[model samples]
Target: MAHIVGGIFTSHVPAIGGAIARGLQEDPYWKPFFDGFHPIHRWLAAARPDVAVLFYNDHGLNFFLDTMPTFAVGAAAEYHNADEGWGLPVMKPFPGAEALSWHIIEHLVASEFDITTCQKMAVDHALTVPLALSWPGADNRPVRIVPIALNTVQHPLPSPSRCLALGRAVHDALASWPGAERIVIFGTGGLSHQLDGERAGFINKDYDRFCLDHLGPEPEALVAHSAVDIVELAGSQGIEILNWIAARGALGPDVREVSRNYHIPISNTAAATMLLETPATLSKAA
Candidate 1:
């Protein structure tokens, strides 16, 4: 059966991608942020999972107010990056795992979670930026990806508990797959910063730190907060924390946090990255 090797949590700020594309890693303003991911890049090189289940929120690129699915999974054979009204360097297309994607969709629906399957979905920075950051060179990234889009942009987003349940369902689904493949799940976006309204540029280091500290063993503590509470504390767009909660749930209750990095003011967001794995996997590695 397919084995879930680990999970990654990250912030998907668009400027981070721009900084990388411009070769500004050494710039004093961006050095600290870029430095944080060096270890993550090395780790990915070693772990080398066969597939990545990326969970992110679309930022008005693919879906609009007209029609939006609360949860959508990409079933396409390949996914191209969309231009989010600005000229961001489009990366190479992301190779998809169609059979695995379909399998996950079927299982998620069967598990009472309604999921929309997309055969031709245009990915935004939320999906591509993190990939670019983690696996810098498009020419050499061998791992196929399965993009899972969550609706954190609109009102009535899924609650933290619901997102966590979805993650658990994903875990169960991957476990049931008959292929002996290594898979890594990713939850992308937010450590806390607002980009709109009068409260723009708000960064709550304390709350972000609180989330980073509790997400591993006591995820329930983070889940206990309502959406209103999350916005009040973490910021409005901070709802993206649901993605992290879901990734946490997929790894199950017991996980060893391999590494973590948090930095402030990464293009108006408190960027953070974390690596986690099942206790059994950690033990085997030891």
Candidate 2:
């Protein structure tokens, strides 16, 4: 049966795409963030998952404000990147795992999650930047992708508890699939940074540190805060943590942190990278 290999979580700051375009990995300001990926590359090298089930939020590329779905899944054969007017170069398309995407769609619906299924979706930096960070260089991405976009862009957004449950349902779906593929979960976006409002350019490092510390062992700790509470503390755009929370749910319980990097002010966000997985013995024993 198909099994989850691990989950990779990171901030999908737009400037990351620009940094890549300008070859700024070693630049003093970008160095700390870029260096975080070196260990992620090493982990991916060792884990070798065949497919990635990505959890991210769309940024007006595929879904606009008026037509956004709370949750959407991609069933396309390939996903292309487009210009979001952010001046970031378009990334090469990522091949999709269509069958697996459909299977996940079916399972989510059966579990009562009401997810929108997209046959053609244009991925933006949120999805592409993480792939670039995990597998740098041309033709380097070795896994098929299954994109799952959450509604972080709009208000009346799903709660942290709900997203967590959605992820758990996805975990169950992967477990029931009869394929032999090894899957990795990608959760993109945010530690703590706000883009607009009176608190514009706001970031809460202490809260971010609390989240990073408990995401694995005590995710419910995060769920205790209301959506309004998150906005008050982490900023408006910081609601992107919903993506990370959902990805954590898909990982199930007892995950070991392989490596983590946290740095502040990565283009208006507190950038973070964390690689988590179930213990090898536990995975095998299951």
By lDDT, the best candidate is 2
The lDDT of each candidate is 0.85, 0.90
lDDT of 1: 0.85
Say which candidate scores most in TM-score.
2
The TM-score obtained by model 2 is: 0.97
lDDT of 2 by residue, 116-215 (tens): 9999999999988999899988467699999999998788989999999999999999989999998999999998988888888999999998889998
TM-score to native of every candidate shown: 0.96, 0.97
lDDT of 1 at 230: 91
Model 1 per-residue lDDT tens digits across residues 1-286: 7878788899988888788778898999888877878877776767768999998998887788677888999999999886685567877788899999999899999999998889988888988878888777655566889998888877777888988889899888888999978888899999898889989988899889999999998998888998778988888988899999988877776887888998878888999989887765666467
RMSD of 1: 1.3
Question: Any runs in candidate 1 off by more than 4 Å, and if so which?
Answer: none
